[model samples]
Target: MMHHLLFCILLFPLSQLVCAREEAFAIVIPSSRLQCYFVPVESANHSKLIFDYQVIYGGISESEENFGLAASESYSSLTVAAETLRERLIRLRKQLDASEHFQSSRRVYETRDRMLMESKLSRVNFWSFINLVAMITVAGLQIYMVKSLFEDHSRVGQLLRRTF
Candidate 1:
């Protein structure tokens, strides 16, 4: 299978894919200068309008011949890189399909829900324990307040009555 894949990759014309001459990119707007360019509506569609700023910086030339040459060079390099990436992905996929890790991945995924629920349950139990403690503490405070209020013989109750 590996030999067959290797043979196909070598024989395939993956490098010969037709790519565009120029790549589209976002224009850089300078904060200092703003200008509007008006081209006749007829020429507005993909007009050879290279900005003066691009020319000043020795950027892409407006010559169609040079553009074609650059495009061909870039396309060849890009296709080679793409083919390498595809080959790597194919190899990795094959490795993964044959490995024990892929076989157990489904089981791992299935257990994730149980693990998450257990985590949530633990959090709920903790909060319940905290609430129980808070309730007990509030009950104790309420008992103390009641005792202080109604027990006439108690010093705390006498103090409270005098303060009130």
Candidate 2:
């Protein structure tokens, strides 16, 4: 019985249930009045025309009135419905809070992972740049030494030719 009641509460359209308890009336104006308000109608035979008007007040239908009365009579059921709705709302709020917490923790973990990747990339780039600079310095020193040795050999050949 409790399960059925809970299922009914979850499935029922609560807005319609609340609306059922309230009474509403529609005020209708005559079409002649509405037409006259927009445009005046001229009749050529005004002397032969006769108008009869009666004031009719609208009231709630008998069925609707009975339904409202029945709803009021079952006030205990309404109270139970209200309590069930409140409990459902509280449960939904707690579920929402838990989901939000889980999402925030996931975001934190993603941010940490991104930071670690960025640091690793930066360290790799730094080592590659240092290696390139060292290679260029070694190549420059080798070139200078080779050029100096060639100049010294040429000078020695010139001195030997002058002595002979």
Candidate 3:
């Protein structure tokens, strides 16, 4: 019984470690200014845009015959990257399907719950418009105040210098 209990305890952590390693994902974002590459994590499900990706590493530029400037840019590299990511995600999905902890039924339940909540939330009114207007007004007032204060201080400094 003692040996059996020890074996179970050892296997539990090993299983967890293996599971964690199986679901691991790595994304490298290279920047010229920053020497080191960064792995960005998804913060929210609603937000699909990746932030701080200013550098364009791999892409083809199309030249315009009539005009001097480039007409368009090809997204072949980006599309290839997206396809690779999708393939990885699909593999992960298949692994998760086989997992005892993560089953299709649970996913369906969660999806239904999320859809229901979103539907209810969509019916409610938001104060976003009012907030946006208030924010713009405050920013405009702040800029005007700063500009006026700077002008007044410079004029006062000029007068004082002239008097001295």
Would you list the C-alpha lDDT of every candidate in the order shown? 0.61, 0.58, 0.52
Candidate 2 residue lDDT tens string, 88-159: 999999999999999999999999999999999999999999999999999997886556556756665556
* Model 1 poorest ten-residue lDDT run: 52-61
- Candidates sorted by TM-score, descending order? 2, 1, 3
lDDT of 2: 0.58
lDDT of 2 at 110: 100
TM-score, candidate number 1: 0.33
**Model 2: residues >4 Å from true position, as ranges?**
1-57, 61-64, 71-73, 141-164
lDDT for 151 (candidate 1):
79
What does candidate 3 score on TM?
A: 0.20
lDDT of 3 by residue, 56-162 (tens): 24322233224343434336756788999999999998887688466767888999999999877765435666678899999997886556555756665556556
Clashes of each: 0, 0, 0
Give TM per candidate.
Answer: 0.33, 0.46, 0.20
| Best-matching candidate per lDDT | 1
